[model samples]
Target: MMITFTRILICFLLMVMFSNLQAQQLFQLSDDYIVKTYSERWELDSVYQQGTFRLMSYKPIYLAPVRWSSKPNDKPTSDNPDFSSTTSFPYNNIEAKFQVSFKTKLVQGIFWGKGDIWLGYTQKAHWQVFNTGLSRVFRELNYEPEIVFKYPVRWKFFGGQFRSVGLSFNHQSNGRDLPNSRSWNRIIFHMGYQNDDWIITLNPWIRLEDEEDENPNIGKYIGNAEINVAYNYHRHQFYSIITHPFNQIKGGSIQLNYVFPLKGHLRGHVQLFEGYGETLIDYNFRQTTLGFGISFADW
Candidate 1:
């Protein structure tokens, strides 16, 4: 027990050491590079001028070599027996994970130059890279594609600026066959606010009625809404995502992340997640996970 404790302590110490080292370079910005405001980040209200069809980062693109889950779901089960896995596989507690997310402007200045439309796609995968005995199979892969129509708002709320409101059609799926398949669709409403370096977003979604439900109880576990908070301080970024069902808070999740600059356009990322819905296959399985790696985008 002492040895295990020591190992964990060492890992934490190393993370702190690297963060400090990388922080030194975070402040060294180029002459032409300008720090962006919350509105500028989304190019809202013509604050940041951009053309259509330009691809941009929608979410944090990251790869973690070490992602440890306290409880690995080897046998994924769902309320729908057709979507539950029949056989259990050997899933490692520690594995590699990666995510890639991007967005492109489809129509700019629509609705009499007040609205914009975007198409976004995000994919995240878990790989059992260290479990060579299982021949290094990909444990789970989730794909999300969304279409958003966003409009900038300029309302004041407690000295903060209400920045934007939007609606999104989102589809998330594992792209798998029966007994391992999981998928869901949602109509999400988005609202964003900004106060100095702090940005907050609320996304409330309703599940679309499907003839053949993949996971009928997914909403009970993954929640119907998300609250995201982000703050930037001297080139260091901190973010948190909280989700919970409206009926109760027992089935929800919280994820915290810290990111600091490492190199040009590259940053070190550390993430901690607790509860359900870390992945599509693990939507109903609760776990605590810690991951350390690098990311190319923020939020």
Candidate 2:
């Protein structure tokens, strides 16, 4: 009777183990299909995620016209009836920017985690055609490469919501092709909080570069801070940005951008920038500009 009881107990244990293994296999298969289906749906909604390897390119043509007036008092002369003279100049400008970028998400995990790397190049050419028949052209080129790592924060500060943080390292350079060309290394920390229609991003970045005449007064160590806020309503998005520099020599810039979607995949961008200190090339101290561009991204 004891031997029979032992054999029966061993058989029961083996059957339970086999049943658990079958259940685990079925669960895994179901989970995998769910992920695959979600990925396909996401791609259909946003063409930006359509491909395993993605490439995007943009070219923009811009025209700018500006007028400046100055008044000067010259030494009183017999031929001159008035001591004050005014001069006004109207300048016509044209600028072109071309950019190309490629990105690939190398790894994706079951826990909604992903890793990606991107490389991009941008070229800008500008021409100034003065009414006085004088013309000048300038060109600039930049190359950037970056890697990013992100994970869900899983903690809520104000309310029960979803949030995430990411760390990235980027290298950008002008390839010494332009005058005063230099390279910079940047470390960026980004945090985002999303609650329904509102999304907020706080980005604090540090930039390091070797001392060069290009950035003379600004020390080799420079810090930058940016805050970005976006509000989404239905299919529309509005964004504003503020940037601050730690060093006086580096200056600061503020921008507001609005996007409106049109038919198909085309979208329009209207941007305004107000800068102080050396942020602007022409005004080295203070400058303001308004610009508009078109974007073709997944809506």
Candidate with top lDDT is: 1
lDDT score at residue 155, model 1, on the 0-100 scale? 94
lDDT of 2: 0.42
* lDDT at position 242, candidate 1: 92
Instruction: Give candidate 1's whole-model lDDT.
Output: 0.81
Q: Give the alpha carbon lDDT tens digit for every residue of 1-299 in model 1.
A: 32243344335434533544355443333321223576766789675858665555677778999999998999999888888887988889999999977666778898879788887777899999999989999999887878889899999998899999999998888877788878888999999999887889999999999878878888899899999998888768888999889997589899999988877666789999999999988888999999999876776
CA lDDT of 28 in candidate 1? Answer: 39
Model 1 has a clash total of 0
TM-scores of all candidate predictions against the true structure = 0.87, 0.56
Off by over 4 Å in 2: 1-102, 110-138, 160-162, 176-178, 209-213, 216-223, 246-250, 276-285
**Per-model lDDT:** 0.81, 0.42
lDDT of 2 by residue, 1-299 (tens): 32243344335434533543454432231212211221232221232244333323211212223312121111111111221124322333333333333333333332443333322222332234332453443323454555555445555666634355666775554443223344456687867665555666677887655444343322222227677776656445566776766655555667566666655435556656566421212212345556556533211
